[model samples]
Target chain A: MSGNENREKYKLNVGKIYEGFVIDHIHAGRGMKLYKDLGLEKLDCSVAIITNASSKKMGKKDIIKVECPIDRFDLETIGFMDHTATVDVIKDGEIINKPKLSLPKTVKNIIKCKNPRCITSIEQGLDHIFVLTDPEKEVYRCKYCETKYGEQ
Target chain B: MRHLLTPLDLSVEELETLMDNAEKIKADPEKYAHVCDGKIIATLFYEPSTRTRLSFEAAMLRLGGKTMGFATADSSSAAKGESVADTIRIISCFADIAAMRHPKEGSATVAAKHSRIPVINAGDGGHQHPTQTLTDMMTIRALKGHFDGMTIGLCGDLKFGRTVHSLIRALLRYKDVRFILISPDELKLPDYMTDEIKRNGAEYEEITKLEDAMPRLDILYMTRVQRERFFNEEDYVRLKDYYILDMPKMELAKEDMIVLHPLPRVNEIAVEVDEDPRAKYFEQVQYGMYIRMALICMLLDISL
Candidate 1:
């Protein structure tokens, strides 16, 4: 087989959006999770997902192209999921704003408290609130139980 | 504005104020007995801890305050799926302050967010037990005469001993407080805790042998190796008797060195050791009540 043919066979069928967002540089294997978490499947907009895309910066990455403008809150939420991700706002097939992702200082109801004895567990209607205690380590702890996120 | 959820919730000055108040309350019990008169303290224990609940109740009673709340989850509305927010909301109407103990790690924090009154966390799973930590501080200050430059040996169950975690965190604010962490490998202090020690620039040594660290310690903080914390019966049986404070171990420690333990001990501290001058665990119980009394007064904003 020709080298060109071999390249074409393995290439992802990711198409660009005329308007909306192109979430780039997602950690490899985490694109699908971000897709579901972002609720792109439920939105009545065109979305393309390219998994295991080769990148010079990141050895392997995933990209999501959406046909609708992403909200600021949604962008920050995406940052929480993968701090390394980059969100590029596109208008008329031209890249506009590319906000750098960072860990939010405080997040509400995003990650559930895992400590079984955490007040969030027994108390109904309580927001599973967490605060970023260690920004360098990207550690979030439950506001109530003080249990570090991912430890539970 | 007062909430005793974690040891950090109280500043060094506030902690000193509490210690001073506790000492004054101890000196003249009758003069301050009625300082909290007509005030109500809600003891919302969502977990069964007889010692902590009683200590809180006794503190309130000694302060001429009335105590009302359930002792267990089954007795409380928690069994009926009532939320901590809801419970605290309802209890705020009846009580001036609330002291809660829950099996869940951050239940009191949830309560504090929703409740209008002050909230004290009696014990919250393996996460925090700040009152016990306060009691420990008061004991250390009384026996050692200061919070500085003490070699505190914490022996047994460092992994699940919430008191050890809280005490260590609280003592870090003091000058030159070092720790001798003595526990078996399986029950060694959690990395998150040790990380805090390293971050605070405090010195600590992790070892398995209690006897080796005894001679160097100024205060021996013994803890019961609780069987309930273990998932496997065989592991519990193996580690339960790892360190027993007896006469020989006491001989190695300084003559003036004190021992502190959150009681209801299950053989980790030998019964014979109670007669020794250094055995301040029983006195710790009294300090727990006194410190709690001072805490209640402080939280309620009563001048005692």
Candidate 2:
């Protein structure tokens, strides 16, 4: 095969969407988690998650292609899940915009408070909310119990 | 509606106003006797804390308001798995305000979020007890005339004493306030607290022996050091005596110095020292009620 043919064969498996979002450079093996966290599986639109894709910046990366309007995406979920992931908004089969992601100030119903003494533990229908108390350390505390995430 | 989940929930100015009102209520109780007439306060003790529940009830009763609600989880709908949000929402329909003490940290905050009426956090596990901190502040201001320029020596269990941590945070807002933390190495104030003291430009010294800090202190706040907090019996025996405030250690303190404790203290402060005139822990209880009275009036937007 020619070099051009070889490059084409190695290209990403997913096709571009007409007007949707392309989440690129997700840390390898995190694309599925990002998909689940964003609740993309519940959406009616088509979504493709490519794992261990070749990358120059990263040794390997994951990419998510969603075939839906940009407004339909919850970008905050992506920011909370993986701030390093770059989000490209595609329009008419062209990359329209690449939005920067930063840690969200607060997240709702994403992470549960593990502290057994937390009110959320016994409450029947309480949302597990966390607030970013220390942005530098990326520390999140349960909104109800103020228990640091992953603390014993 | 307002809620006192933590001491920091009230700004410095608001605290001043609350203190001023508390003093006024202390001076002439009759003037504010009927300020909260026809009002109701629900004492929602999801955990059993008799002292705090009684304080809230007494505060409301003194203000001509009636009090209601359960004193323990088993007696309340919480035993049947009622959520804090739902309980508080239901309480709001009956009471003008609520005072809640829960075994879980941040439970009061959860109640406050859903309630239509104001919620005062009596205590929440080891998280916060804003009323206790407020009472401490009231006692200091009543005795010392102000919160500024005071050297406070906090002895015993600095690591897990919620009142001590809340008091330190509250006092850090004042000027020229220094902390002399006296605790064993194992129970030393956490690094986050010391860092917070430094970050706020407040001065503090951590020492193992309480006697060394006695002379320079304007106030000595004592908390019980539990036996289980130590890893072994030998360390507990060696360190237990150092934390106890007795007449001998009281001699090293300045004559005008006051001693305070969030009580139910287990022999940490000797009975002999209680007669020292400067032992203000009992008076601290009275101050707790006064502050709660002032707090309820303020939260209900009632004025004399």
**Predicted complexes: DockQ each:** 0.79, 0.64
Residue B60 accuracy (lDDT) in model 1:
94
**B191: Cα error in model 1, Å:** 1.2
Candidate 2 residue pairs in clash (backbone atoms < 3 Å): none
- Clashing pairs for model 1 are A117-B104, A117-B105, A118-B105
- Judge candidate 2 against the unseen true structure and give its global Cα lDDT, from 0 to 1: 0.87
Predicted candidate 1 versus true structure: per-residue lDDT over B4-99, tens digit per residue: 999989999999999999999999999888888899999999777888899999999999999999999999988888888889999999999999
| TM-score of the second chain in candidate 2 | 0.93
Compute fnat per model: 1.00, 0.88
Q: Which candidate comes out best when scored by lDDT?
A: 1
TM-scores for every predicted model: 0.94, 0.88
TM-score of chain B of each: 0.97, 0.93
Query: Per-residue alpha-carbon lDDT of model 2 for A5-79, expressed as tens digits?
Result: 999888869766898999999999999999998889999999999999988999999999999878887878898
